[model samples]
Target: MTRTLRVFRWSPGEAERTREYRVEAARDTTVLDALVEVQRSQDPTLAFRYACRVGMCGSCAVVVNGRERWACRTRLGDLGAGAVRVRPLYHFPLLRDLVVDLGPHAERLRRALGAFTPRAGAEPYARIAGDSRERAAIDEAIECIGCGMCVSACTLVAPNPRFPGPAALNRALTLQLDSRDGAGAARWGVLLGEDALARCHGQGTCTEVCPMGLQPTASIIRLRWLGLSRLLRWTG
Candidate 1:
């Protein structure tokens, strides 16, 4: 059961380094469990983040073997007997080993007008039909759990900081599609900005790495089409 875990080690005001830990773990054990074991038995200073170890909270996301995954849900057995390399999610400020600051991602969402604003004077008990288009649209884009995996997987964020990443754009799409949301046109306007939706470039990495099964690529395409249609209407 002995395994070699190469964990990225860093702290504020220090150069980043990789520290390898030898730990005994079962084959079915998750990477997060192995990390916890390493921290408990070998090194107490190892820093990582996890909540709801059953994978619901999405806080345990890390880069394992060069791909983003939920550390809590990724089994060592699935990796097939190779050294495991764990690092914080990419494209965010690394706080320490396997932990990154999510503040910038949240702020990007805020700048993109991702919040839901209810329509003025809308009835509190408005009934939405199960088969309605708005209901379907909302359901399509509302499942993001804010794991920041999509943001890490998106390469566009590296050069274009203003690009609101997949999660924020997905949130904007959900709000844009909701009939009850008051920020519909304004949200679209924000998304149409130079550093916003057009920067996505139709890369499927976000969709591929999303643990929640959300298709951010498709959402971006839909939003762009809507934005273009609106622009045409205005110009015509």
Candidate 2:
């Protein structure tokens, strides 16, 4: 069967336009596969990034039919039959046809102090129990692939560029729970900044669009609770 792909095409300082290409593909063909076919036979100038063709790399993410998804995992069968509208992930600066700049999101993660710092006298991981509370608390957050999907789906990031967005907050939550982490105070300071977690309106868009099944909204709520507790302690 044949399908039409209306892909967004643009570059730095270039007028944006949508180019439609029709290709033959099976219903089971992945969007990435179809794109590869289009590039091979249709347009050689099309630009997009994909590493693992499986869902692990998180590099082939795009806005498909008004939703953010990994092209490798999203099957043409699932989209039904029609022109598939493909665009770069929203809430990010478009670099080209289907690529967006992820550097901003990475910068936010860095500003959030999303690194781990072991506390004094902390035992090595070999000595720490696998089922310990600290490990359990961060298990889900560690599953994030840094795809920037959460950041793109986040409503706050579009309006408030300074908001750290879900991915960064999720990273902060993981580090915040680390009993060995000695940067809790500093991390909290960043999360409590005027343009940080408080700007999150609990839209849950980030959680819904997360392909990793991670609940970033829940993490933000937990961070809010932690922030409140700290405020109370400071006041008392």
Candidate 3:
């Protein structure tokens, strides 16, 4: 079977354009597979990014048919019989066709203090009970692969670049809930900033487009609530 892919194309200093390519497709063929075939047999100059094509790496994420999806995981058969529209993830600098710079995303994570800070004199190998509240709080959010889909779908980052985005805020959520992490007030300070958690309009676009089934909107809400509780206790 043959399928048509309308892919976004551009280069540094080149006018952006969409190029269509026809490739042989099988029932099990994925968007990634189709792209590889196109690059190999159709257009060798085409560029994209992918690693661990099994969907664990989250590197091959692209906008497919107007929604963010992992190209490797999205099977051609799953999409109706129409041209598959492939484009780069939005809200980031485009490097080339179907590839965007993730540096801004990483910067937001850094601003959110996404790294874990060990508590002073804490146990070297402390174990958290599976049923503990801290464990439950982050269980659903810890699997994020940093694919930038949520960031691309988020509406706030474009207008206010200072907003630490869904991915960064989601990372902060996991670390904030960690009892062993000593970031404490320092982390909260960033989350409470006007451009950080407060900028989230609760649109849920981030949650809707997340490839990992993570609820970054909910994570932001949880962080907001945590910040409020801290404020109340401090005042009391």
Candidate 4:
């Protein structure tokens, strides 16, 4: 089937341009398949990122037609339209067509200074009791595959670049509940900042776009409660 792909093109070399591309794509083909056909058969300069097109990699994510989803997982036939619009992640730096530079976000998580800090060089590992509240908290968002579909759909990140967004905050929530994770002030420090949980407006866009069904807004709320508790304790 011949369909037009409304591709958003941009790079450091070119001033950013949007062009519609008509390509012959098979029915029931995924958006990734259509993009692959366009790149290999149509335009060599087009750029997008994908690996393990089975939706496990989370690299083929893009804003398609207006919704944030994984291209590899989204079927083109599912879209009732003559054209499919593809754009880079809303909040990240545009590297090129459909590809956004996620390095900064990734880097921030690595430097978050939590989950790595042990408590006073204490016992080998902090024991996590099966029925403990912290243990249950970790289980809430531990299934995140890091596909970032939620982050792309997040309105907070789109308007506030400093917001650590859903991914990092989710990670923090996982650690916050981890009894073994010796993160005290460090975890709250990173999670409560502007780029962290505080920036979330509870719009629930992240949860809606999450393919894994993880609730980020819930995690943020938990973090808020944890922060308030911590602050109250410190003052008292």
Query: Taking the tens digit of each residue's C-alpha lDDT, what string does model 2 give over 1-236?
Result: 88889999998788999999988888789999989998888789899999999789899999999999999999988997789999999988888999999999888888899877877677766334679877887787779999988887888887887788899999899888777788999888899889888899998999999999999999999999989999899999
The models' CA-based lDDT, in order, is 0.89, 0.89, 0.93, 0.79
Say what the RMSD of model 3 is.
Answer: 1.2
lDDT of 2: 0.89
TM-score of each: 0.96, 0.95, 0.96, 0.87
Candidate 3 at 151: error in angstroms? Answer: 0.3
- Ranked by lDDT from best down, the candidates are 3, 1, 2, 4
Off by over 4 Å in 4: 122-134, 193-195
Could you tell me how far off, in angstroms, the CA of residue 94 lies in candidate 2 after the best superposition? 1.9
Cand. 4 Cα-lDDT:
0.79
Off by over 4 Å in 3: none
- TM-score of model number 1: 0.96
As a whole number from 0 to 100, the lDDT of residue 227 in candidate 2 is 92
Candidate 1, superposed: residue stretches over 4 Å from native: none
Model 3 Cα lDDT, one tens digit per residue, 1-236? 99999999999999999999999899999999999999998899999999899989999999999999999999999999999999999998999999899998888888899988898889988878999887987999999989999988988889998999999999998999898999977999999988998999999999998877899999999999999999999999
RMSD of each: 1.2, 1.4, 1.2, 2.5
Top-lDDT candidate index = 3
